[model samples]
Target: MSIDRLFPNLTEDNQAELERFGDILKRVWPLKAKHREKLKYDIRDMSRGLTTERSERKIDYLSEARFLSPYLTYFLPWNLYRMSRLFTGLELDIPDGSEVADLGSGPLTTVMALWMSRPHLRERRINFTCMDRAPKSLQAGLKLFNAVAGENSPWRVRTVKANFTDHIKRKADLVIAANAFNELDWSGRVARPQAEKLAQHMAGATTETGRILLIETGVRLTGRIIAEMRTQLMQTGFKPIAPCPHVEECPMPATGQGAPWCHFNFSVKDAPTWLQTLSAEARLEKEGVSMNFLYLSRKGGKDWGAVRIISEPFKFHGGRAQYACSHKGLTLVDHGEKQRPLFPGQSLVPNWPANPKTDLKSGALILPNTKEKR
Candidate 1:
């Protein structure tokens, strides 16, 4: 399975649909011309806060109009776009009338993405409970969701003004916390008490056959936090479904000094041009986006016999190479003749030769799997 098979390629039709969604967003939340001018400054400030000054102490920025407006206009659509890509890649097995819980759901971004990406679930009656600490953001999200959903929508949405750490009242078929856990600060250490607690809360809220999806920014610190949570969740009886071919110890060393973290990068070429202009005007141009994610279930996941590519293609000895993780742990895959280049987040199933060579620099097995196909 080439990494291309794992994600939706941006066909012309898909690009048109994305543009239409962007139009819908503008229609639902139109800002005055002067308001747009001020929004850029607000976006710059918020971007700085999220990336540079990510302190452990939490702030209610969602409640402030200055922050909330820019967030809804700029950050919300970008996040929704990112989530749509993720949803398209996933294989959701939700039943009719299933319940979904979105923790730290700022303006129902994940809920909207699920609805847009998975049209097959539109007819089914799904109950969505969005939990957040900011009432203003929740209210804005509810209104926007209703406007986007329009009349006679089968999905029911309700808002709860509470923190994500609060105990969930019911077990849901799917529990999603996109960009939520990154709010919890970490010390870049492998072991943290927060990961254990968050895993417990997520586990408690998931049904026996349900699935949980956690997404965070693709940064070194966030990678360490997710790696720790992966261990914690496995100890709590959950198995990772995606991004991990085998449940063996993660070989992407997300800890220690200057260790490389595990994450994936996705192309943003399909994003609407208007959005790109807005982002550039705000001084935050995004050519691509990166995320560290984990999808887990109590029951086992897809039949696993493939190598998941974790790093981008890099030059190796005058040839192309990529870092992949498989049952054999971390590996350096040397591209073979006529083999298509593998991108991050893609998986490849190859016939491994006996006694593969080992790379001295990275200490990873070298697999010259050429002419391999799914």
Candidate 2:
């Protein structure tokens, strides 16, 4: 089932808002037929900003409604879907009346995803603050938020037109940075201290019992930057909550000798038709959405025994081998046909036999013995 289907009513409501937002964009930025043909090219170029040179990362068209229209139609839905998956998979326990802050919250994507994922919080009097460096983007985000959240909603929405890394001064119960952390200068050649400073700031801004979430493009450099940030935050006493089973040093970094970085894929089969169309027109992959994310908290109480599947299962003659990471370290686990299929980001506790009479079916094994029955 699609992630959005988990909350049918809420998903419908969110879709309605998305349609309304799209309509507003079209009316505000009516494009001529000739200009419409160039949208795909424009989107293609804009998409390259994630890995392009720092000077080329800025999309000046972001301030124009004409460009923003296509972006909203093509990118927003998939991002929302990814955010929904992240929130659902992590299963965060945000309390009632919590103050949530989203850094680099372009067009309010993360906030909208949060609302859609946790519809129960709509009536709980929450405060949502969105900060971005782009004034126009913040304005657009505010409009989207107001359209989705009517005047009667209990959410107190606020938008700040400032760079989140420099202007954020208040603490929040839940802090999120989506598709923004990679913008910080962390290239191998340049050692920008801003990356560590931002991590420290986020760690310090989180309230006790609060959680911090960071999402970035599922690319090699972004994954490495996230791993470095994880190490920095861990040194400051923040423990990883998801995608990592233990608070030890990250084993997979881009600098490692061909070691795979941490990332996950979310199926986008249920994305809106408009997004799918634009994705096809832009010649982008439409089946799966990839992202690298980290969830952390000051408290450390994760189930260390639960191991995370880090790679796809490799099928053999009578069984499969899956690479996984656990508190102990990385291991290749052999699984019989009776064992459940393992996907990336899935966590399972291994049941090892201590005696001859112990039942192995009660819990899955991390690595099955070669002599064991397949």
Candidate 2 deviant stretches above 4 angstroms: 1-34, 52-55, 59-67, 189-192, 315-318, 336-340, 352-366, 369-374
Model 1, residue 264: distance off in Å is 1.0
Off by over 4 Å in 1: 1-4, 10-17, 56-58, 188-191, 336-338
Candidate 1, residues 270-369, lDDT tens digits: the string is 8878889889999899978887888999875675578888888887877788888888988888885456568787888766888888888887888886
10 residues in a row with least lDDT, candidate 2: 1-10
Give the Cα lDDT of each candidate: 0.80, 0.68
Q: TM-score for each prediction?
A: 0.93, 0.82
Please report how far candidate 2 places residue 192 from its true position, in Å.
Answer: 7.3
Each prediction's total of clashing residue pairs, residues at least 3 apart in sequence or on different chains, is: 2, 0
